[model samples]
Target: MIDITIEKNLKVYQGKQILKINRQFLSGSITKIYGPSGAGKTTFLKIIAGLISPEKGKIVIDDITWLNTDAGINLSPQKRMPGFVFQDYALFPNMTVLQHLEYATGDKDWINRLLLLGKLDTLTDHKPTHLSGGQQQRLAILRALAIKPKLILMDEPFSALDPEMKAELIGGLKVVFKGLGATVLIVSHNPIELEGLVDGELYIAG
Candidate 1:
């Protein structure tokens, strides 16, 4: 399980207040972080993924300690074993879908499977600019899965896709996660979109 207890300053409309979060995330289960906008959802995920630091906190995943301000220990993002999918679907402009997958890991077989699963097989050689919004999002997800990370953090991953496309992508993700047995944490404002996607929920507030 991933255990986290952290407090950071967040800018609210009135002023700045300390955002306190303490939770335990179980492995092999899809967890959804549900809240309204500006509720510190993205901040919490970023902290866990080691992309942002908390003012005071301790984060431990599995049995590994990722951060402990009191102990003067903080691991870098690369050492955190997290596969993160940004909200904007951050794909390299110049790289092809295949190149993105290959850059995550040198496993060509897994790349091929992910390509087939994400319906990106035909767009392997196409760059990010050549694909549609949904296709680019799928490519980003495929790149994250290629790493076979211990935890997957997604920030509004399907917001850009239509309902039908979202359903199809979620189906593909289910198969991939089942095969890898990886834990997933997603941040989204739409709870309905998470109907069959997550096993539990983590509600956050500003």
Candidate 2:
């Protein structure tokens, strides 16, 4: 299980806001995180992934301390190594589709599987700039999975894909996630975007 109790200050148009969260996430579960704009939803995920530091909080994953601000303990993102899918895709501009996965892992079989899952098997040589918006988004998701990470954080990961494509990709991801026993947190503005896919929900108040 993953336990988190964190507080961070957010600068909004109104003023500074405190983003507080105290929750426990079960192992190998998928959770959907949604809230009003400027609610610091993305920041919440970043904090958990160790990409952002909280003013005060402690995070424990399966008895392991990932963060403890009071004790001045904070793990680097590389040490934590949670797969992250940024809203902007965050793909390497200079790398080809295959290179992205290759950067994460040397497992050729796994790379091929991810490419097929994202439906980018035919575009392995294509760079991010050469691919369409939806394709880029899919590649981002695939690259995240390439490492077979145990913790995955996705921010608006499916925003660029059509409903049909999104549905298909999610279906394939279900299998991959189960195989990897991953715990996933997805941030989306559309509440119903992950309707039946996620097993839990977290609504962060702005």
lDDT score of residue 185 within candidate 1: 94
Q: Once model 1 is optimally superposed onto the true structure by TM-score, how far is the C-alpha of residue 12 displaced, in angstroms?
A: 3.8
lDDT (tens digit, per residue) of candidate 2 on 1-206: 99999999998996799999999999999999999988999999899889899999999988889999988899999888888999888899999999999999999999999999999999999999999999999999999888888899999999999999999989989999899999999999887879888999999998
In angstroms, give how far residue 151 of model 2 lies from its true place: 0.7
lDDT of each: 0.88, 0.93
Worst 10 residues of 1 by lDDT: 188-197
Scanning candidate 2 in windows of ten residues, the lowest lDDT window is 188-197
The residue pairs that clash in candidate 2, if any, are none
Q: Which residue runs does candidate 2 get wrong by more than 4 Å?
A: none
TM-scores for every candidate against the unseen true structure = 0.96, 0.98
| Residue 127 shift from truth in candidate 1, angstroms | 1.1
Model 1 TM-score on a 0 to 1 scale? 0.96
